[model samples]
Target: MTPAQHNTPAFHDLFATHPRLTGLALAPDGTRLIASGQTSDADGTGYVPGLWEVDRAGDDGIRPVTGSGPGDFAPAFAADGTLMFLSGRDPGERGGTGDVALWALPERGAARRIAHHPSGIATFAVAAGADTVAYTAALLPGATDAESHGRLRRARKDAKVDAVLYEAGPVRAGGDGEPHTFVRHADGAPMDIGGQGLAGNGDTALSPDGSLAAYTRAPTDQAPDTNCVVVADAVTGAERHVFSRAGNQYYHPVFTADGSALVCQRQREETHDTEWRVTLVAFDLASGAETDLLPGFDNWPWPGRPLPSPLPGDGTLWFTGDEQGHCPVFRRDADGTITRLTALGAYGSLCVTPDATTLYALRGAVDGPPRVVRLDVAAPDQEPVFLTAAGGLEPLPGTLTEVRTEAEDGCPLRAWLALPEGASAERPAPLVVVPHGGPQGSWSDWPWLWNPWPFTARGYAVLLPDPALSSGYGQRMQRRGLGGFGEVPYRDVMALTDAALGRADLDAARTAMAGWSFGGYLAARTATLTDRFRAIVSHGGMWNLEAFQMDTDMSAYFRKLFGDPRTQRERYEADSPHLDAAKVTTPVLIVHGGEDHRVPTGQALGFHNDLRRLGVPVRFLYFPDEGHDIGVPNHIRVLYETMLNFLDHHVLGQEWRRPPLL
Candidate 1:
C-alpha cells in the first residue's frame, strides 16, 4: 500500500485494534532473532491478551507461541534455538498472585510451562548461552512480611528443577537489596552480582568477561544530586567505589571490551534547563582513576532525543547524538576523534551484531510508533533495511511549540503547546491544561501515547507548562517548588493558562485541567483554588496528604516531598488538596486503578467521598484490574471515551449536563 493509503482512517482502525510490539532480542550467533509481542483477540464481549513469536528468516515464519490468553513478555533465546519467556494465565490478576509461569519455546509453534508460580512473575532474563535462566518472582503476602521482595532464581537447561540464588531484602549498609541485577552468563549457572540500592533507578552494566559489575548509586532520601559508579568483583562480591561525581547523575553504564574502563551518559544541571551530554570515561580498575575519553558530547540539543547506544568494542564507541536538529550516529575512536555514521531519525536501544559489523536500531517519533531498522555501519552510505513498519500505526501530524511565559513572580516558565493540523488562530478552541506528574519533571516533546490526539482531533488545544520545580532546567529551578507545592507551581500553571487564554484562538471560558499522579494532585488542588476551569480530571492523584502518607506505598518518599507529616502536620495540611475539597466549584472526574500500589486506591476514593459529601459535582471511574496507569487497550478506550464525554458536557455544555454520581 502507498504510504498515504497506509495511514488512512481505515488503516488506523486496523492498526489501533492490533497489539503493540515491545521487547526484541538477537540470538548469540547473530544469524537468528526472536521477538516477543502481545496480541488481543475477541472472546465473546471482551478481548484477551496472547503471545506471539516471529522468525527473521524461514519463509517469513510468524505464528502464535501460546494457545490461550494471558500476557507474555521478556522473550530470550537459549543455546541451540531454545526460547524462554514469562507468561501468565489471567490478564486481570494483581498483587503478586496469579498463575504466572516460565515457558519454553522449543520451536516456532510449540510451547510448555516449566516453572509455575501461584502468585506471579514480574520480570525475567536469560543468560547468553541460554543454559541458565534467571528470573525475579514476587513472593505473596503469606510468604513474606514485606509487601514485596524480588527473589532471584536460576535453572539449568538439563535440570528438571530450579534453585533460588538470592532473595532481595531491605537495604542493608553494604549488601544488595532487590535484584536490580542484570546477569551476563558466559558459562555455568548465572552469577548473582547486583541488587537494587541507591543506583539511580535500576541501570546496571556487566563487564565484558562477566567478572565485574558497574552501577550508579544515588542517595535515597532526596531527589539525587549526584550518583557514583560502584564497581564490584563479580566472583567475590567485593565492592569498591570506582568513580564519583558531586551534582550530576551518571546513567547507563557500559563496560569496555578489555574491562579496564566504563562509559556512561551524564546529565548536568543548568539554570532553567538541564543539558544532557554523553561522555566516555575510562576508569582504571587498579588505580581507580577515571580518564575522560571524550567529554562534552551533546546528543542533539533538541529535546526528547536519546543518546545513541555505545558500540560494542574496546577504545571505540558508536553512539547516537543529535546535531543540527537531526539524529545521527557517531563513532568516537580511542583517540577522541568522532565520525558520523548514519543520518537516521531518533533511535535507541542499539543492538550490535556479534560480529560487530552491523547494528540494529529502532527509529520513530513520539506520535509515530517504533520500527526496527538494520544498518550496516560498515557501509555508511547504504540505506538501512526496514524489518517492519510500526506495524500499521500512523504518525499523528503535530508539532510541539515551546513558549516562555512569565510567572507571577516574573520567573520565566517553559510551556509546550501541541497544535493540531489545520487549526486557525481566529477559531477559539477549548484548552486542556495538562500538568506533568513529577513536580520535578519537565514536559518534553515525547509523543503523547495516550488520548491527547482524541482531544486535539475534537478541536481542543493542549497546554503543558514546566513550573519552577521542573528538572530539565537546573537545581535552583527544580528546588523552587520543593516546599511550595501548593503555592508556586500552582501559580505558575495558572499564569500560563491566563497567558494562553490571551491568545485569540483560545477559549478562556472553556478551559479544563487534567493530570496524572502529582499532576493529578495539582489539577484537584487547582479546581479548589480557582473556579476558572469548567472541569477537571485526575488519575492516580493524591487527595489528602495525611491520608496519602498513611495509605500510599511510598510513605518514605513522600516524607521527603512534604517532610514528616507528624512533625510537619501544619505544612502537610496547608499543601493538601483534600483540605479545600469544599471549595471545589468546578465539576471533577476522578479516574484510578483499583490495584494501584504506588498511589493506592484510597486516595482517589477519599476525594470522591469528600466531594460527594460536599455536594460537589464529581464522578469516579475505577479500573478494577489495572495498576498505577491503565494498560489494557479496552480500558484505555473507556477512559478516553468517558473523558471526552465529560469534557463535552462541561466545556461544550452539550447533551449531558452532569454525571449521575456528580
Candidate 2:
C-alpha cells in the first residue's frame, strides 16, 4: 500500500481501536505455543484478554485457545496439551479489584478457571516435571490488614490446595516498607526457592536436574550502588554472592544445563544511568570466576524485550539485537561464532520451546502491528511461519530518517525523524518533541505500537531523541548529565531545537514538547525554563521531587535516586520547576491518571494550582479509572484531541477551542 493509504483515518482508527498484543510463550515440548495479548473493538470498546495456541509442525497453525473476554494473560503450559495461564477474573466470570486468577485449558478447547483470589496472581510457571506450578501473588493495595506484600506460592498439578513457600516485604524495619520485592522461581515450588534484592529487576535460571537456582539482585530503588548476582541452594534458600560489581546492574541470569556455570547480561553504571553494554558473562558456579561470552556484541536496550533464551544441548545462545537497522534474531555458539537466525525486519519478545529447536518471535515493521512467527533455528534463512495475523490495525507507511545533532556541551545526540507521506523537506512543518518516559530509556526505530503516530498522522514532524541520560550508549555517555535534569537534558533539547530550526521542513518556532512520567517532568520544566515552545503536555509527572518522594508509592526508591529530602533539601528545591512557576509563560496541558500510584494525582493538581496562581495558561485533565497509562479509549481520545487543540491554538495560531473539563 502507498504511504498515504497507510496513514488513512481507517489505519489510525484501527490502531486506536485494537487492544495491544503482548507476552508470548511456547509449550514445554516445543510442539504447541501460547500467546497473551489484548483486543479492542472499533469504537474503542472491546478490551479483552486473548489466548491463542499454534502448532509448530506446519505453517504454525494458529487459533484462539480461549474466547475473547475482559482479562486473560501470563500463559504457560503444564505439558504438551494441558495449558495453564492467568485470567483477570473470578470463577464466576466477574471482574474483580485485583489481578486475575489461574485458569487451565486443554490443547483442543475452552479454558476453565482453576484458582481465584481476592488479591490476585502476578505470574506463574509450570515445573519441568509438569507435576507442580509456582507463582507470585501480591496483596491489593488499600486493603486493610494485608499481611503479605508479595509472596511465592506453589500448588500441585492435580491438587487444589496452594501453599505459600516463601514470603517477603511489608518491611517496617527502616521506618518504612522495602523499596520493592518479587519472587523468582528456578523450577516450580518446594524445590524452586530464589530471592533477589528490592527492585524485582533480575533474572532466574534453574539447572537441568533442577537442583540449583541462580539469580541476579540489583537495588531497585534510586540507590546508585548495590548491584549483584547470587547463587542459592534451591531447597534451603541460602544465597551465596557469586558475582557483583559496584554500580553495575546485572540481569537475565541463566544457568547452563549442567548447572556448572551461570550466564547473565551485565551493564555497568558510570554515574546514575545504566550503559547498554549487555554482554553475556559465564560464571563458573564452582570457582565463581566470570568469563565474557560475547564481549563486543551490542544488544538493543529496550524494556520488555526478552533476552536470548539459552538452549540445553547446543552450546549456542540466542538473542535479539539491532542488525543494520532492524532488530533481528541472532545466535552465538560456544566457540563465539555468531549467526543470524531470521531475515525478517525488527522482532522482539522471543521465546524458545522447551526442546530449544524452535523460536517464537513477534515480527513487524515501523508502520504495522506485529504478528507472531515461528522460526526454525536449524534453517536460518527459510521464510518464517506466521502463527497468527494481527487484526484491526493497518501499517502507516513513512520513511524513518535519522537525525543527529550536537548538544550544547558538544556531546552528540541521536533522534528519529518521521515525516508525512508526500511532505516535502523544503517546507516548514510543525514539530513535536516526544521524550520517552524512562529518562533512562532510549527511543528505538521500531514502531511504537501505541504512541506518536496519532500526532504524526496530522502532518506533524515527530522528533524523538536519546538524550544524555538515555541508555544504550556506553556508561560514560549515559551519565553525562547525571543530577542535571534541568541543566544538561534541557541543553540537549534546546540544541536539538536549534538544529531543527535550521531544517527548512521543521517549523521550530511552532514546536511543542510532550512526554509521560519523567518525560512529563521535563516537558513541564521546559515550559518554565524557556518560552521557545508554543505549548507543553505532561502525563503522570512530578513538579517537586521532594514532595513526590514523600507521596509516591515507592518512596524508598525515590529517596535512593534523589536522596533523603531532609539532608538534600536544597537540591530538591533547586531542581524542581514548580519552584520557578512564575517563569512559565507558555500554554501548558497536564494529563494524569488518578489511580497512578507511581506519580499521584497530587503532583498534577499541585502544579495546576500553582500555574493558575501564577496566572499561567494551563489545563488539567484527570482519568479517574486509569492508572499510570490511561487505557480507556474515550479517555485516550479525549486526551489526544484536547492536546491537538492546544497545539493548534498555539503552534498554528488558531483560535482557542476549549475541551470539556474533566
Candidate 3:
C-alpha cells in the first residue's frame, strides 16, 4: 500500500464514518462466523451495525446478513445453529415501543423477533443446552409488571423532575444502573427475577443444561463494591447466593460441563495495602463446596466473563489475559493446569466451535484494528490465523514500534510508539504521550477510544506506555503503584518516553501529553512535576484528589486508594495535582463530560477554575450530555476534533482552528 493511502481523513469524515467491528460468535457447526460491524449512510447520519457471516478460511468472502440503517449487535448462537442478535428495528414491526429488540436468524431463512420489551434490553443470555432465553430490562424501584414499569417511566418523563433519589452509593457513571429486572423466557412468557429485583450489572451466564443461571450482584452500598454470585433456576427464577465470602468479591459465574457446579473468578483482598488478586474457583451446588481452579493465576477476568469460548462438551474452559505486554489466551485443565494458548497481541469476544477444537476471537494489536482470528486451543502450540479480513481497518497513517525500559524498582515497562509514515531523522515529529487509564488498565490491546491514529495523522508521534498499574503484567507489577499512584508508574512512563525520544525521528521539544480517567490524573500530575511538554490535555482527570474521592459514584472504591481525605492528607497532598497547581507552567486543556459520575464533572470544573484563577493558559471542552465516556456520535467527533486542534496549536505551533461546535 502507498504511504498516502494511509492518510487519515478529516475529523468530520473520520470520526463519524470510521468503521467498528464487534460481537464475535461462532456458529455451532463452525462453518460460519458471525460478527457485527459499523455501517453509515452516505450522510453519516444513519450509523448502524450489520451482521456478516464469514467463512472459516474467508476464501468465499463475507456475506451480509442484514441490509442497512438498523442498529444490529450482540450476535449469540444457540444450540440449534440459530444466529440470534439484538436490533433496533421499528417497534410496530418488532412489537415493542423501545428502539431495540431481540431477533433470531435461522440458518436457512429470514430473521424473526424472539423478544421485545418497552425499556429495551440492557443485556441478555441464550441458554446453550435448552431453548430458554433470559434478558434484563430497566425497571423502576417498586414496579412489578411491564405495564407499571412503563407507566412509571412515562410519569418521570412527564414530571420533568430530572431528579434521582439516591439512598445508596455508586448512583451513576461507573456503577450499574438501578437493579435491572431479569426477564427470562423458560416456562412461558418472560418473567422478572423476583419481588425485589437483583442489584447487579446484568452479567448473565446460563448453564449448559439450561436449568440454572448465574449472575453477579453487588451486595451493598459500601465504599468498595463487592460482587456476590447469584445462582437461580432459569425457568423458575428461584435464586440463592453461592460461594460468597465476607472479605472477597465474587463474579463471572459459569456452570461446569456437567452443570453440577459453577466456576467463577474471585477477587480476594488479603490486605488493605496490596492490590487485589484474581483467581478461578469451582463451586459445587450440592455440598456448597468451593475449590480453587488455577491456584496461582493472577490475571483478572475483567467484566465478569466466565471462561473463554467453551466447546459444547469440552471439559476445560479457555480465557484471555495479559502477560508481559501482550494479551494472550490460555486454557485450564480439570486438574487446574493452565496452559497459554496464544503468545502475542490482545484477544476479545472469544467463541469456540461446538466441536470445541477451534477457537475464534477478535484480535488486535498496537498497529492494527480489530480482526477475526482463529486459534486451536487444543493445539496450544499453533499460532492464531486471521480468519476473515472483514474487520481490517483502513491503513493506518503511521507505523508502530514497541519501546521497552525498566523502572527504578527494576520492573520492566513497555509502550507502543506510533509515528507518522513520513517521520524521519530530518523531519522529526512532535510527541503526544497518552498514558492509559485503569490505573488498573493497559494499552496492550486495540481499542477505538483514545486511539493514537488521529495524533499521528497530524504529524505527531503518539506514545502509549504500559505503566505500573497496567494489567497483563503480573500481580506483583500491579502492586507497584497501589495507593501511591505517583512513584513507580510516573518513572516508568518517563523512562519509556526518554527511550523513545532517543530515536532521531522523535522530538522531545514539541511534546504534549493527554489521557482520560486515571491517565488524565497522571497527565495532571505529570504537568505539575515537569514542564517537559508544551501542552497537556486531561480528559475527565482527577486533579483534586480529595474532592474526587468524596464526589464520585465510586467514592467507596476511591476511599480504598486515598483513604479518609482528612486523615490521609500526606498522600493526597503529594499525589493530587490541584495541591501543586502553581507549579504547572504548561498550557492546560481540560475536557470533561458533565454527566461523568466516575470522575465527576466537578473534577474538571475545579481544575479549570484553578487553572484560570492561577492565570494558567487553559481551555475547557465540557460536554453536558456526555458521561465518563462520550456516547453520542456527534460528541465523539467533537471530542477528537477539539483535542486535535488543541495539540496542533500548542505542540506543532500551528494556527489554532476552532472546532465546529465550539
Candidate 4:
C-alpha cells in the first residue's frame, strides 16, 4: 500500500468506521474459535454485528461465519461443537420480535432460531457435555406459563403502560420486569429453574453433564440488597442456595469439573470506613462450606472470572487480576498455590485449550487496540503469540510513557502519559489531564470510550492518572479516598498531572482537564479548586452530593458510603461541586445523557445553570435518547469532535470548528 493509504484513520473517523472484535467463545473440542465482529452500517449511524471464525493457529486470518443485517452477539458453543449466539433476527415474515433470541449455527446448514422467550433472552450458556442451554429472561409477575406471560405483555403494550410495580425490593439500574432463569435440552422444551430474579450483573454456568446450572440469585427475602449463589437441577428445576452471606456480595459462579464445588468471587459490602474488599472463594456444593481461595493476595481480581481446569476433575481454577499497571492471568492449583500466568498486557475473554496447554485471550495495551493472542499456559513465563493483527490501529501518533508521583498522604500515584510524536523541549505538546471514571476503575487496559488518542494525535500530551480510589493499587489505595470525593482522589490526580506537566516535553501553560462519570466529577471539582487549567470538560458528572445520593440509581449503596443525606448534612455540603461553582473561572464544557441512571442528567443541568449564573463560560451537549453512555456511532463522533473543538478554542487559542453534522 502507498504511504497515505497505509496511514491509520483519524481517531474520530476510525471510531465511526472501524471493524471491531468483541466477546470470544471457544468450542468444547477446541477446534473452533468464534467472536462477534461489528462493522459500521450503510449510514454510519450504528454498528451491525455478525459472528466470525477466528483461526487459532494464527496462519489463516479471521473470516465471517454469519450473514449480515441485524446485530448478533454473545457467542457460545454447545457440546456438539455447534455455534450459538443471541440475535434479534426474526425467522418469519412477522417482521421483528424487538427482542433477542438464541440462534444456533450448524457446520453444514444455515443458522436457525432454537430457543426464545416472550420477554427476550437476556443471556444464555450451554453445558459443556450435553448442550443443555441455560438462559435468563424477564418474566411478568404471577405469570405461570409463556402463554400467560405473552398475554400480559401484549395487554400492557396495548394499554401503553410503562410502569413497574415493585412491592418490596430495592430498584436496580437498567432492570426490566423481572429476570427468571430457564434451562432446556438440545431438542426438548425449556424447564423453569424458577427464582425471584437473576442478579443484574451476575453470571451463570452449567455443569459439564448438564444436570445442574449455577447462577447468582437476587435477594428475594427480607434482605433487600443481597445476592446469593444458587445451583439448580436442570432436569427437575429444583434449586438450592449453595452460598449466601448477610453483608457480602457473591457473583460469577462457575462449576468445577466434577460439579462437587463452585468457584466464585465474594465482595464485602462497602461502608463509610472501608472500601470494597474482594476475595476469590470456593464453595462446597454438598457441604455448603466456603473457602478463601486467595487468602493473602493484596491485589483485586477485577472481573474475577473463574474458569474450570481443562483436565477432567482437576479442581483447579484460572482467573484474571489487576496489579500495578497491567492485568494478568493467575492460576490457583488444588494445593492452594497461586501462579501468575501471562504478564505483559491487560487480558480478557480468556479461553483455554482442552489439553490445558494453551491459553487464548484478547490482549490490549494503552497504545494499541485489543487483538487475539495465544500463550503457552504450560510455560508461564513465555511471551504471547499474536493471533490476530491489531485492526485499524496503525502506528500511534505518539509514545505512551508512565508518570510516577507521591501523594501528600504518602500514597504512590501513577499515570499514563501519551506524548505526541516529535514532542521535545523546543516544541512541547499541550497537555490534557484525563482521569478515569468509576473512581473505582483503573486505566490499566486500553479504553474504547474516553480514549486519549484523539487528543494525542492533535499535538496534545494526555495524562491518564489512576487516583486514590482507582483499582489495581490494592485496598489501601482505595481506602485513602474513603474520607470524601474531594480528598485523596483529587489530590492524587492533581499530583500526577503536575508531575506530567513538570517534564520538558509537555507545555504546562496550555493545559486542559476533562473526564467522564466520577472522573467528570473530579474534573469539575478541579475547576472549582484551581484556575491552572485553561478549560475543563465534565461528562455525566455529579454536581450536588445531596441531590446525587437522593436520585442516583444505586441510592442505597451511595447512602451506605456517605450516610443518609438528611441526617449527615455536613458531609453532603462539604464536597458538593455545585456549592463551589462560583469559584470556577475556566471555560467549561458539560456533556450528559438524559437517561443516565447512575448520575442523573439533573446534575449536569444544575451545574450548567450554576456556572452560567456565575458568569462562567460554559456549554452543554445533551443526548436525550442516550443513557449512562452515548452508544450511537454518529453520536460518538460528535462527542469527540466537539471536545477537540472546545479544547482547541479554549486551550490552544484557535477558532472553534463546529462539526457540520451536528
TM-scores vs. true structure, each candidate: 0.70, 0.79, 0.92, 0.95
RMSD of each: 8.1, 6.5, 3.2, 2.9
Off by over 4 Å in 1: 1-18, 27-35, 43-72, 76-85, 88-206, 212-254, 261-284, 287-347, 353-359, 373-387, 390-414, 420-422, 440-449, 471-477, 566-574, 657-662
The TM-score-based order of candidates, best leading, equals 4, 3, 2, 1
Error of 4 at 53 (Å): 0.6
State the lDDT at 332 in candidate 1.
Answer: 65
List runs of model 4 lying over 4 Å from the truth: 1-9, 66-70, 93-98, 172-176, 196-199, 220-225
lDDT of prediction 4: 0.80
lDDT computed for candidate 3 = 0.74
Error of 2 at 132 (Å): 3.7
Would you list the C-alpha lDDT of every candidate in the order shown? 0.60, 0.64, 0.74, 0.80
Q: What is candidate 2's CA lDDT for residue 261?
A: 74
- Candidate 1, residues 1-662: lDDT per residue as tens digits? 00011123433234335655554566666765555565544632233444454444334544555442355666666656666667764333421224566666665565666554434444554433325444443332223311223232212224643333332211222222332443434344334454445223545655645566666665444444455777877565578655776655576666665566666766554322232233456667778777765554433222221222233444666766543223455666667767667654555556666666777665554345555667775455345666765454444534455556887666777676665555555566788998887564555423323435556655667888777666545344555665657778898888888887777666777889998887898998898799989999998888888777666655544554566767877777778888888888899999999878778898998899999998899888888898888766566556766776788888888786443323
Over 445-477, each residue of candidate 2 has an lDDT whose tens digit, in order, gives 344322666766666777776676766554555
**CA lDDT of 538 in candidate 1?**
93
Quickly count the clashes in candidate 2.
Answer: 5
Q: What stretches of model 3 exceed 4 Å from their correct place?
A: 1-8, 40-47, 66-69, 94-99, 158-162, 173-177, 180-187, 195-199, 222-224, 268-272, 301-304, 308-314, 390-393
lDDT of 3 at 653: 82
